[model samples]
Target: MQLQTPHLTLVLISLLSLNCGSWAQSAFTIDSVKLTLLPGNSVESGTKVTLRCDVKVSHSFPQLSHTFTFMKYNTIIYSKNSSQAMVERSFTPARRSNSGSYQCRVTIHSKEKSSNTETLTVRGLQTPLLRVESNVVNEGEKVTATCSVPEETGPLQFSFYRNQQMFMILTSNENSTNTSVEFQESGESDLHCTYRHMEFPDSSNSSNIERVLIQPVTIIPSIKVQPGLEVVEGDRVRISCDVLGHSKNGYEVFLTDRETLLMSSPSSFTHSFEVNASSSGRYVCKVETGKTEKISTAELFVAELLSRPVLSMSPQQVFQGQMLTLSCRTLNINQERITKADVKFELYKDQHPLKEGHTFNFTASQSSNGNYTCRATAKNITKESKQLIINAKVPVSPPVIRAVGQVIVGKPFQLLCESELGTLPISYTLLRYQRPFYTLTVSGPQRSAVFNISYINHADEIHSFTCQAQGGAYSRFSQALNTPVIEPVSKPELSLGFPRGQTFTEGTDVSLYCSVQQGTVPVTFFWYRVGSSRPLFTSRSSVTRGEHVIRSITRDHRGKYYCGAYNDAGQTQNSEPVTVGVNLAGWKKAVIAVICILILVLIVAILVLFLKKARTPRKRKRAVELSVKPARPKSSDPMRMSLTLDIEDNTAVNNTPGVMGRNVWSDHVSDSESDDPGREEECEKLRYTEIQPQQPNNPEEVALVVEECVIVNSELQDGTQEDPDHQTTDSVEYVQLNHCNQNPE
Candidate 1:
């Protein structure tokens, strides 16, 4: 027996252990199970997988052991220990090495029971990363698809879209990448690729929305259109719209007048409406799209045709060749309401046109006196303005020149110039030849020129005066003339005399005089001295003789002088001056006395010599008588003639009155012969009777001979007293007689 001694011990121990468990019970349960996956739940690779082993309850000291295990597809993947409230568990993502399912298993143990088993399911994950570089494809290009996996590299599929609609798909390897299908040209499409993963999810999304736009064969529609200004009547207007594209069909165009459509067409659109003044409204354009129900619109404004333009008048009436202007205006319109072509205008006189084209301007003249009109061409139309009438004025004529007096001096004469024909506002200018005299201004009432002056004193004055007239637009002037009038210079009075030419000895004063003959005004007088180039002194004229006196004359003052007088008019000629020479003291008187005395003394000496000569003649006569005594027996002495001699004058010798013939000499009667005239003759005869009648050889004998005698003493009748200054002069004249012995006895 191997140990028979323990049979009773083993049976007793087993019953005890079983008996204790009947009194104590166990408390435990399956807590929970949580599942996770890496590309394992319909997702991609490179993702984490989480496994949770959660317990709801646990008995203290009675819970012995807990076991948790993770599995994939009934295969163990991972596991962990758990007690009282269990936590979670995790697993890594699987590549090609982990393509399977996943689950969880729990084992529990307590004091009286054996361990228990609980099972949960798990799944593995698998993923593949794939990409395609180019999805859009032009024509005739090779297609390719590239797929990449961490465990194995392979091929993929690519597709394309046309106009956002799918079209084609393709598959390729890394050597030849995959892309969209090939065609003849490019177009708009979308492209994507397909990828398969053994470790993760089966497919993936695309890179981005791939768009490929193609050059299309279709056309595009037009844009909007508008107008700058309003539409006008009769305008060949372009009802235009803004459009773009090469498609030129299926378009409808029309022009509108507010709500009403004036013209419409599919082919020919805008109306070139030749409008009149009555045609005008709001305008616009309407169009339709090509082969579509769409509409394109453009609005425009057609303004009312510019009111018939009119040209007007200011002073419509004027003379021919007068200046004027005509103004043209567009009527019945607001400011700037129309465009350039809306308002048409032109000017005309009668039917003749002014400007070649449209404008609001015109010119007028004297010849422009007719019905005037304006031609207005607005839009595509024309009109003629209302007619305006004009009247004209004529001009006046020029007048003749006239005078009021014969003379135009001393404020008494007047002259007038007038005009019968000239324009209004005529102006006149009075002139003496080219020299201006006076001026006159006139409009209508005052149109005359008057000249007035008096007192014509000039004797031979002459002048030719003129007047001229001017008015509107008279480029030249009209003129006329009158007679002429010279004045002479006045005469001056004069006097010529000296104050006292001889007051004038050495140191006294002397003057020259000047007086006017008939003049009354006080006259200025001047005295001129000779030897001087200018006047030595000056004086003035008065009622009395004007004297110019100079004091204390020297020797140099002995020169000529003259006096002159002057008034307001001018000066008179000078009068001659008298000179007075000055000498030293008493010398002049002494010289005169001495000259007279010497002259008297010479006369006395001359008388004495006359007496001596008288005596010699007597002696000669006595001697002659004595010599003749012897010859005449009866010779008696009687009164005989005696001789007189004037020694001062030898020419007085023949001047005795009785010498030529015996007159008063007689013989004395008492002395016998003196009483008888015959006896006196006989005595004289006998006295001369001869002694020796020969030439006397001795002068003593000749001396005793008597010659001739002079008698000066005579008596006047009535016996007036004889002047003592007169005395008897006895002079003698003796000659040698020849042979006196024969003398008459």
Candidate 2:
């Protein structure tokens, strides 16, 4: 026999493929289940919830040998056994009959189903009432309080507290049933409130502790300022008040400063008032006694008086062997309680008495020259000050400062200054190296002072010239004329103090300051290098300031570089052409920091190979051999049903829950349709067909998917199945399964 007829046709095709996979898993039923909940069914009573149980399996049995229980209202509450098509249960403080009905049965291996019972309410939050429109409050009085919560709990959030801390948070309005607040006392104790539910964890319990007393603080009325409050502006101050023990026949008093009220007395203990100068501020002293009113403030401070006597004179003009100083101080305008009294000064001269106390030393003659007058008598006031004349003069010799012309390079020169005799009208001053430049004032009596000297550079050749001669407070100087050493050459400027866009690479250091804004010193400076004619550096600077450093910069220190500036009046000035390029060295910045660390390690290895191919886990889509057909070509109302699928492996096609749509799919597909190859060949010939309608203990029926439409072709549409204008006309045929989180075993 030909190989035993091919091993008896492969054992009858392996016993008809194990009897068609045991009749596709015993004609799989137990199709619909679901019971979810997890974080919501309106929870909150002590929190912790869960519940799960999924199990719907039958898209040609992609896996489902279940056994989950759960229940809740009919009792059970959790029983396992899973090949898992989903199962869970938690609870934690969840009671109140764990909130009514919840379902979830499942079973599968022998059929069973259940689900849809749902409910779960669990509320519980209500404990916050805190009231107090009054329980005694009178320090600065106001105390309101309120709080509430428990109007069937919904939009809460209050907070208040006080002796236990918190203090105010009442949000105010979401149907605001309570949550007031005024609080003003200085002593209270225990007050509370605690509503919750705004960011929910549903809190509420802390509200019945009201104890609040807060009363103390009424004793004010004391004001007493007689010789006090530091008065003194014509002082006679008295302001008293004292009503703390009240009585004077229903009191009255008054006296304010919180913006004026000044005086009102009647319950007098004293209230004189004199320290004026706008009485300086904060006063008060209330009293009232009728509806309980007692104030008391106090801060006065007046001061204001003296204002005058100043007189000063040291050397205001007088010379004959010099010596004269006169001073007389007073100034009070409120010398803080004014007290330095015994002062007495007198000077007069054209009117006779010459001098008496608060400082007066004299020696200048012409009989101590004239028109003086200073008086000042304190304690009883007498102020005179202001009248000083004093002209004693006579003495002016040392002058003779030279320099007269033609020391040229540009003309103009004349200094002259002369005073070798004595006072006629002095005041000269010309100095140069000692720096005073020029001054001349020989009023009317002529004592000589020329000073013309127009412009001469080279720092005027080491300057030296002097002359000075005043007369009254006598002044004299001279003796330093040696200035005239052949001067003139000015013009030299060359700068490069570097650092400004600086770029000198190879071993750095490049200084260049060759100066001479007006030229004078030994100068010299020279630097060149443009097209090179020699002289790359040379310095001298006796003071015209010069410099030129280079330490290392190679390639002949790059290009264009000017500088020049010579002196000794020999003339030379060039500067203004710097250039020197070529930078980035240090081994080319260490090879550009090692090529920017290999281009940031090749962009972090291409972003770690695109995040390890986006955290791996892909390659799946293996089984694909679909071929279905079911035709129904051109026929308008024949109730359409044209299906023709032929997938073999452009794999990846999914639609989960019993495969494809029976009305619930669209979590908007596209995980890029498994890397899109035309959407993975239109998701490998997608297909769907639907027709559910078999209730009897409903477990959500309609299954058998390959993306759905298992096989249909009917036509019905003319409303009336209990009309709400009902209409119908169905004809389907779809397929493309496998997606329930994939690995469906």
Best by lDDT: 2
Q: How would you encode candidate 1's per-residue C-alpha lDDT over 233-342 as one tens digit per residue?
A: 54445444333453576666665666777766664433444444444444555454432322354444545556666676655544545655666776665335456555
Q: Which segments of model 1 are wrong by more than 4 Å?
A: 1-507, 515-562, 565-594, 614-745
Model 2: runs farther than 4 Å from truth? Answer: 1-135, 141-236, 244-293, 296-745
lDDT of 2 by residue, 360-392 (tens): 887887777777777766545456777777776
Best by TM-score: 2
Give the TM-score comparing model 2 with the true structure, all chains together. 0.29
Provide the lowest-lDDT 10-residue window in model 1.
711-720
Query: How close is every model to the real structure, measured as TM-score?
Result: 0.21, 0.29
lDDT of all predictions: 0.47, 0.62
